[model samples]
Each structure stands twice: as C-alpha cells, then as structure tokens.
Target: MKTRSMYKAERTSLNRLPDPVLETILCLLPTKEAVRTSILSREWRYKWTHIPKLRFELRDTTSELTSDIETAMNAMDMYDVYRVLLLHRGPIHELTLYFDHYWEHYEAFECDQIILHLLRNHTLNKLTLFGLYETEDIWYKLPASVFALHHLTDLHLCTFDIDHPSIFNGFGSLQKLVLSYVKISTKTLLHLLSNCPSLNTLDLHIDDYEHVDNCTINELLKCLPLIEHLTISGDVSQWLVLDSVPQELPTLIHLKYLCLNQYCISGDYGSAFLLALIKCSPNLEHAHLEMEYLLEFSVVKDKYSDVWLAHLNTLDLCFCSSSLEIEFVKFMLARSPKLKKVSILTVVDRKQDAKMVKTLLRAPRASRGVKICTWK
Candidate 1:
C-alpha cells in the first residue's frame, strides 16, 4: 500500500509539470540527450522537435557518443539532421550550426545543396554559422535562399565568403550583424547595409580589407543611420579619414557608445576621421580609442582636440605613444566640463607614469563628479 502511494505521488508530480517547463528542461540537454528521450514514451517522441531553439553541431570528437554508436552515427549524414529539423513544425527562433572541419572531404556542391534545404524551411530569427571552407572558389557563395528569410533579426557569419551583394535584399529586419573573415567588395557592403535600416549594433572582425574600394567613411556612415553601438577591431588605417563634414549620419545622433581597438591613426585621414566622429556623434557618452601609432597633432592640434574633450563623458585611452599625455589631460579638464569619469591605461610597462596621471586627475574641474583611474 505504501509503494502504491509513492507511485501515485510520482505520477502526480510528472503530470503537474507544465509543457513549457518540460520543454525548457529538454532544450537545455544536448541534442543527443534530447533525441534519446524519444524512447521514453509516445509523448516524448515528438517533444524534442517542439523546442524553439535548434542547435545542430557536427564535430569529430570521439567522446560525443559511445564507441559502438559513433561509427553508426558517422555513417549517417547531414540529411539525417535535415530530417530531424523538418520534423519540427514550429517556427525556429534561433538556429546555430557548426559544420565539421572535415567538410573538405565532401563535394562543395553537396554542402551547398544541404544548406539550401535548411534555409528554405527555417524561419530563423537568429542564426550563426561557423565552419572552415574547403576552398576559396567563387562557387562557395551562400545559398540564395537565405535572402528570402525576411524574418531573420540577427545574423552572424564567421569564416564565410560572401561573393554576391544581391543576397542582402531579404535582411531588412536585421538589427545586429557580426562578420568575421568575410571577403566582399565595398560596393557589396554598402548594398547590404542599405537594406538593414533597423541595424543598431555592428561588430566586424575583418582580416582582409583589400576588397573595400570606392567607399569612404562618409558613405558607410550614411548607410547606417540608426546604429547606436559600433565596435570595430581591424586595420582601419587605410580608411580612417573624412575630407568634409558629413551631412549624413544625423540619425546616428542617438549613438552613445563607440569602441575602436588596435587601430592605427596616422596621416591626414586620421584627423579627418576624428573630426567627422566628433561632428556626427554629438551625443556620444562613452568612447574607447586604442591608437597604435606615434602621436602627431598635425591635423587636430587645437580645434579638433577641443571638440573631443568637450563632448565625451567617459574616455579610455590605450597604447597611445603621445608625449603630450599631460596636455591631453589638461585639455579634457578644460573642455569637457561635464566629464565625470576617465580611465587611462598604458599598454606598455610604465609604472613611473602613474604618479603624473594621479596629479592630473586631482586638478579642479567644472564637474566635481570627475574621477580618474590609471593602469599600466
């Protein structure tokens, strides 16, 4: 009688679990674990497919499955994964696929065929694809079907070659885009950006910049009118300049954060670029600049330097080789009356310079809220 009562309590607890709660628990498990649950009962068989977030990863890890099952799983292909995906009738809100590096052994055409199949059926709101391609051949362009998925809000592509610009027409709803090691022309990039009017955040990790021609800083800024957060880490030395104050980018007036790292600021172009930023982002609240070149104030000697110091509330300067660090500090104290916080980090080993930085921060300013921290 006690055993019967215990069984009844267990059944009650299982029945009390809401479908959403059960789904959440299942979603957190690995794909293999989720699939194995199908053996439990008829209700569990189709439960894995109901998960809103689908992640399919293919790797050569030996520990992924038991020794006996690994061989059988290896015999199966992407088609099996596609079948599993098709079983899910619900909308796929987030989809991530990490293709195995061994994809080079298969025909490129086969890979494209499989990817096209996935893109056709999935209405992905967020998608991330990362894999090593077999070749740099032009035939490696992303499946054209991707452009038809207008529902995608966030897209991340890493180590992929986007050879065509027309593939961007369907990304009008995209709000965040991250690209790494992508090879595309500046014209293509402009065309892509023109479609994403709602884009608010952009992160770029460009290893190659030779394809960027016939596009200037002003033209790029004009395309992304609503971008509020911009994080750029690459070789912008070639393109960092503005010959004229941009009439465009007024919409970027809402831009509040900017981060630039490992950027080389040299030549007349650097000055123009800095001036354009100061003029365009008048409401910028936070900025980080890591300049890796010798400091020469030829272009921004007095006029532009004052503009930066006046507007910035939080500023972090890293790896600057300027001899006039004190001059910059004095300029900030005088121009940025409302500036309340500052962090100066010297990338090189320079413990002796902290004393001078401390002295500069203690100076009286219009904003008594000002605080400074220096680290080497």
Candidate 2:
C-alpha cells in the first residue's frame, strides 16, 4: 500500500549508503550502466570510479550490432576504453573488454601498452579480452606481458598469438584458460602450459594448428596433470591423426569431464582417439563426442586390454555415419562395465532415428544394466 512518493523517498535514502556499499552495487553493473549513475546525483558521480570490475562491450550476439559499432567507433573505441581504465582507482577484480580491432588506422602498439598497464597494475581475478575476428583486418598479437599476470584466476583471450619469451613465470595462480582462434606453436603452447601448475580447466577453439606432431604433442599434454574439465572443438585436423595413426598417447589421470565437438577426423582415428582418451581418464564420469570419422574395415575386439572407464555413467555419440564407428561404439558398450546409459545421436529424420535406436538397443552390451537410447 506504499504510495509512489514513498518509493521515491526510499530510493533517495539509498543514495546516502556508505561508499563501500555503493561501490558494491556499481561493481555488479556493466561499465556503461555504472557510469550512467553519475547523472543520478552528485553523491553517485564518483562512485563508479571505485568499482572492482569494469566491462566494456562493443557488440552483443547480433552481427548487425557489430557492424553498427564498426560504423560508429571508426576504430577509435580503444581510446575510450583506455580513458575508462585511467579513471578507475584501486585494483580491478575483473575486467572484460570485447571490441573490434580491425581497421586500417588501428594502433596495435598503443593497445598492447594499455593492456599491459591494466595487467601490471590491477589485481585481476578474471580477465577476458576477445580481439578482432579472423574475417577482419590485420592480425594483432597480444603483448608478452599477458603471460605475466600472477594474480589472474580465469583468462580467455581470442584472436591473437603470443611470442615466445626468454623468461616465463606467470599465470601461477590461473585455474582456467580459454583460447579461441589463437595461433600458437606446439612448443610455445607447452611452455605456457608448463608454467601454469595450478590450472585445472582448458578450452581451445581454433580453426587450425601449425607444425603439429604426435610425439611432442603427447609429451606436452602430460604437463597439465590437474585438468578436470577439457573441451577441444573446431578444426583439430592439423593435430588429430586423420592421415595416419597416433604414434604416441597421452594419459590424463585427473580428467572427469570431456567434450569433443565436430572434430575433423575420420572413423578409425576418431575411435582410436576416443579410446585413448577413455584409457587415460580412468575417473571420467561423462563424455560427449560428435564428429566425422573414417569408413574403413572395423577393427574392434571384445576387449581393449584391462582398461576401464570405471566411473563413466553417461555417453553421447552424435553425427555418426560409418559402420566402423558402429563397431567402435559396440566395443565401448562391451568395454564400459559401469556404464548406466548411452545416447546415440543421429542427424537423420525421425523414422531413421527410430531404426538406429532399435538397432542399438538390440546390440550386445557388457553392462547388463545399461539403458540404450537415441536422438535426432
């Protein structure tokens, strides 16, 4: 039963809250929204300066909005971001800036300096900077100082490459890292990962890999021993053994969650890759694998040694076509003793999906208690 005037009075009283409390409220808002509060009153004019986090977003999910920003900013938006950081006081807990850096007049060196300044001065817990897309102007490499953030906990950098540094001792406190369309050599990538001893999560999304070989790749993967959640999507054809066989296999003893999305590998290699992963991750609880594979002669036995996905409870197989893949699926069905449910996914119509489901339901399984299902 409160009148409209009473609500206004209550809201006006909120302006008198302690500065720390007001900064907490501002920290939850986006940088633009927080800055807008300055017009509310003289008391709120400087509250945004003390916020612990600042996020400047140039575009949202729509590509049209991206075009709009490109039209409006004319590639001068970096200065605005630099000014915002310059105005912010104290250590920023989190900073996420996503803007287009693809323009003929863009100053790559200045942007690099600005990013380095933020990393050097802030005690950031989460830092995400997504650079320009691949379909744009010249490529921009992130400053080597990005690897020297000792206070970062979660980092996601996109559309850039890192130069090999003479000395590396950063990302010691980092727990999660995500790289999208990042150009990195195997040797450099290994060196970076080796420095992050506390890292537990890694997500890689790239269109290609350079000079990828199995011998060194397998060895380097061993550097990340504590990773529990792993997601490798996009074009892995360069690293995945599609033209030949895996010369070496990497074992991960701590992995529990895995997702392989639309990898460009054939059936035999796909089956072999998944088997190798299952063998390595003994404690894996769930897996989602959906990709292309070879259509060669099936080579699967009733047993694949004493290896067991002992804790695995759910399996999702999607976009399968080859009969060799069916054998691999059957082999996994016979291999997983503790498996409780398996979902076979197909891109066919409802009738075809029903037929595949029926076929799989009739297939022999090692886990007598496992339920078989299908989806289209």
Candidate 3:
C-alpha cells in the first residue's frame, strides 16, 4: 500500500496539467531542460515543439561540461539542437543561441544551418546570435535566409561578419537593434538603418574598419528619426564629425535621452553641429555628453536662428577642464527655459570644480529653477 501511494504521488506531480498548459510551463525553461520533460511519459514525447521561445547557450565557464567538451560531446549537443529546430511546429517568437568559444570552425556550419532552418519555417520575432569565436578573423557569416523573416522585431549579432548579403530586403520591422563588433561596411550599415524605420532604441558598436562615407555623423543622424535613446561609441566613430547639416533633416525632434561616450569633438564641425542637433530636439529631456579630447572650433554658418531647448530638464557633461565646455553649460542654463538640474564632471586632477560650480551658478540667468553641480 505504501509503495503504491508513493508511485501515485510521483505521477500526479508530473502529469497534473493539460498538454497546452504543461507546454507553456516548460517553455519558460532553457531548451536543454525543456527537452528533458519528454522523459516523463509518451504524452510529452514531442510536446517541447509547442514552446514558442527556444534558447540554447553554452559559455566558457568553470563548469564541468566546459572543461571536457570532447568531439563526441559536441556532436551530441549539435544533434539535439538540430532536432529541436527541425521538429518545432508553431511560430517561434524569440531565439537566443550563443556558441561557446570551445567549438571549432566546423561546428559553426552546423549551427548556421539550424539557424537558417529555424528562421525559414517559423515567424521568428526576435533573434540573438552570439558567436564567441575561439580564433580571430573566424566570424560566422549571416546567411541570406535571415532577411526574409519580416516579422522579426529585434536583432542582436555579436562578433559576426556580415560581409556580403545575397540581397537586402524584407526588413524595417525591428524597433530595437544591438550590433556588437559586427563587420559591416558603411553602405550596408546605412541600408540596414534605412530598413528599420521605427528604430527608437539603438546601441551601435563601430570598429576601426567600418564608418559612414557619404554621410558624416550629423547626416547619418537623419537616417533615424524616431530615436529617443541612443548610444554611439567605439574607437573609429570617436573622431567622427558633422561635415554639413543636411538641406533638411528628419531630425531627432522627439529624442529625449542621449548619451555620447568616447566621441571626439572637433572644433570646426563639432560644437555648432551638436548645438544644432540639440536645438532640433525640442522635446529632449535628458542628455549626457562626454568629450574625449579638447578640439578646436571652426565657425560654421548658422543652420537655424534663435536656438532654444525649451524642454530640456537635465544635462550632464564630462571632460577635461575647458572654457568651451563651461560656455556650453552657461549656454544651456540660459537657453533651456524649463531646465532644473545640471551636472558637470571634469577629468582634470586637483582642478577647482567647486569654483567652477560657483561660476556657473553666478553666470546663469534664464532659468531660476536650475541647480548646478560639479564633480571631479
């Protein structure tokens, strides 16, 4: 009697839910763990395919599996991954697959095939592929199959080379994109941006080899109009400047949060163009600008008269001490009628930050609500 009761209890816990509800619960687990649910009974044999989100990731951690990834072990893992993609029936809403550095070049091909097959058959909405290559210059090229998944709304590719796509179409659905260390040319980059018409949040990582040619930084801003939050960083993009403001701009009028880190500001095209961009962003509420090195300012003809940032409320600037940056602080305090808070951080050692704060406190006039602060 005791043995029978224990057996009944075990079955009750495992097979308590309806098939649809059980599949939904299992989908919350990683793909590897989700597949194991089939061991419960014949009823769950292929139920894992009903999961809408499939994720598989292996990292180079101190785990025992990473320590002994033999050829047989890799083959088994790849087989399981392929089987999951091949059997999945419903529309996959998201896929996150990261290949550890332990895998060799040959293994990447298998993974690529699985990715292509998954994207082709399913209405995949979000995809993240992190190819942590063990060897340099051994980047997994994205297949032409990815472009057709028009339902895709988010994409993230890390350390992948998108050298020559077979064709460029079936895009413009993505609203959030993150490309970290992707090898794409300027032309291809622009084309990609043009496709994402409603891009509101962008995190772009530019390499020393990739840059915009026909468009300078200012002109490139025109490509993204709906951007409310932006982060532009990396070595090559640091020194980029605005050659000329466009005849007309699809400006960042609605942009409210902006961050520019490690970006070089040349005096000639830097100061005015930045001010012009800020003026265009009338609804901008928060801004953080970092200047890497002091640069000369060249006089550009005014693109717009009566510069006003009526909606700006907070501004943060960090850089080595300079009179120009201070002038910018004073400029903001005077122009932004709704300003309330400002922060200035100087990279200089033993500099008079408190004194600078006092100076800004005294020189500012337009907004009485503004509270100026400085950091060393």
lDDT by residue for model 3 over 1-376, one digit each (tens)? Answer: 5797897677777677787788778778778778877786676777887888888775433324544545224323566677777777777888887776635534456655766787667778898888763455656666555666677788887877664464767367788888776777766777788778878878877543633344466546767888887776664333344565443445687688877664534445556556666766778889888764664422432444466787888888887657766666676777788888888778765546766776788765633867776677
Rank order by lDDT, top first? 2, 3, 1
| Per-residue accuracy of model 2 over 86-196 as CA lDDT, tens digit each | 888767888886665332245346556766887678777898877776553334567666666788889898876655568767578989999887777666677778888
**Model 3 local distance difference test score:** 0.68
Clashing residue pairs for model 2: 266-293, 266-294, 267-293, 267-294
Question: What would the TM-score be for candidate 2 when compared with the true structure?
Answer: 0.81
Error of 3 at 264 (Å): 4.4
**Model 3 residue 319 CA deviation in Å:** 1.7
* Global lDDT scores for all candidate models: 0.64, 0.69, 0.68
Least well predicted 10-residue stretch by lDDT in candidate 3: 67-76
Q: Could you estimate the TM-score for every candidate?
A: 0.78, 0.81, 0.75
Candidate 1 structure lDDT: 0.64
- RMSD in order of candidates: 5.0, 4.4, 5.1
Task: State candidate 1's TM-score.
Answer: 0.78
lDDT of 1 by residue, 1-376 (tens): 5797886676667656899998888778655567777876555677788887766665544325445765445333566566766677665678766666435445346556655655676566887776654434322345455566687898887766665434356477899988766666667677888888889888875545665554567777887888888877666654333445453334467687887774634444554455456556777878876655554445354555435434578877664535554555665566666688877776555654665665675665833778776677
**lDDT over C-alpha atoms for residue 110 of model 1:** 50
